[model samples]
Each structure stands twice: as C-alpha cells, then as structure tokens.
Target: MNMSTELIGMVAGGVSTAAFLPQALRIWMTKNARDISLLTYCILGLGNVFWIIYGIEKSSLSLVFTNSFILITALVIVYMKYFIIKD
Candidate 1:
C-alpha cells in the first residue's frame, strides 16, 4: 500500500468510527435507548466482530481499529438498551 492509499484508509476509518460516538454519548448521558433498535445494533455488533476477524486475518490495521471502535460503541448501545434502560 502506498502512502496515499494508506492515508485515505486511515481517514475513512476515522470518520466512520467517529460516526458512532455521538449515538453512544447520547445513550450514555441520557440513559435512554428506547428509540434505538436493539436488533439493529446487535446485528451491527456481530458484523463488526466478523470484520475484526477478517481484518486480523488480512493484517489490516485500519480495518481492525475501525471495527473495534464501532463494535465497542455498538455494544455500549446494546447494553444500555437491554440492561441499563428499562424502556
């Protein structure tokens, strides 16, 4: 991978990973995940796990890092929805 390609991957990964932060933060601060779909986030977390495995197999740092962060965020939302919030 050339410098430019690697840079692009990093930038893309950063942006995508950052996209989940707001939702996680909102759920954490508000302690409400009623509006968030549990099924969707659960599926997303599963997908992220698979992606992490693939990234590891391929030795792609960007993929591994990005999916890990997203997976954590998804798990947080899932936990909040299922465990923390009653509704």
Candidate 2:
C-alpha cells in the first residue's frame, strides 16, 4: 500500500466511523429512537458483524478496526432501541 492509498483508507475509515456518532448522540440524548427503524438496525448490526469478519478475513486494517468499533456502537444503539421500545 502506498502512502496515498493508505491515507485515503484512513480517511475513509475515520469518516465512516464518525458518521455514526451524530445518530448515536441524538438517540442517547433524546431516547427517541422512534425515528430509527428497529428492524433496519437489527439487520445493520448483523451486517456490521459480518463486515467485521470480512475485514478480518481480508486482513484489512481499516475495515477490521473501523467495523469492529462501529459494530460495538451499533449494537449499543440496537439494544437501546429495544429497551426503549420495551419500556
């Protein structure tokens, strides 16, 4: 991997991981995951898990690290949505 490609990968990973923060913050603060689709994120969390595995399989540092971190956060959101709906 050349320096330019590595930089692009790093940038892409950072952007994607950071993209989740705003939605997470909104959900955390408002506890209003009503706007968020439960089924969608349930699927999304599972997708994140798969991506994490794919990243590992491919030995992709950016994908592995970013997806793992995002998956943790995404799962948190999924759980939060479930609990909120339950209550």
Pick by TM-score: which candidate is best?
A: 1
Off by over 4 Å in 1: none
Worst 10 residues of 2 by lDDT: 78-87
Q: Write the per-residue lDDT of candidate 1 for residues 1-87, one digit (tens) a residue.
A: 567776787789899989988988898888888899878888999999999999899778888888998998888778888888786
Return the TM-score for each candidate structure.
0.86, 0.79
Tens digit of per-residue lDDT, candidate 2, span 1-87: 467775787789889889888988888888778777768777877888898798788767777788777888787777777775443
Candidate 2: residue 84 Cα off by (Å): 5.3
Q: Residue 49 of model 2: what lDDT?
A: 86
Write down the lDDT that model 1 would get: 0.86
lDDT of candidate 2 at residue 80, scale 0 to 100: 78
Candidate 2 residue pairs in clash (backbone atoms < 3 Å): none
Q: Candidate 1: worst 10 consecutive residues by lDDT?
A: 1-10
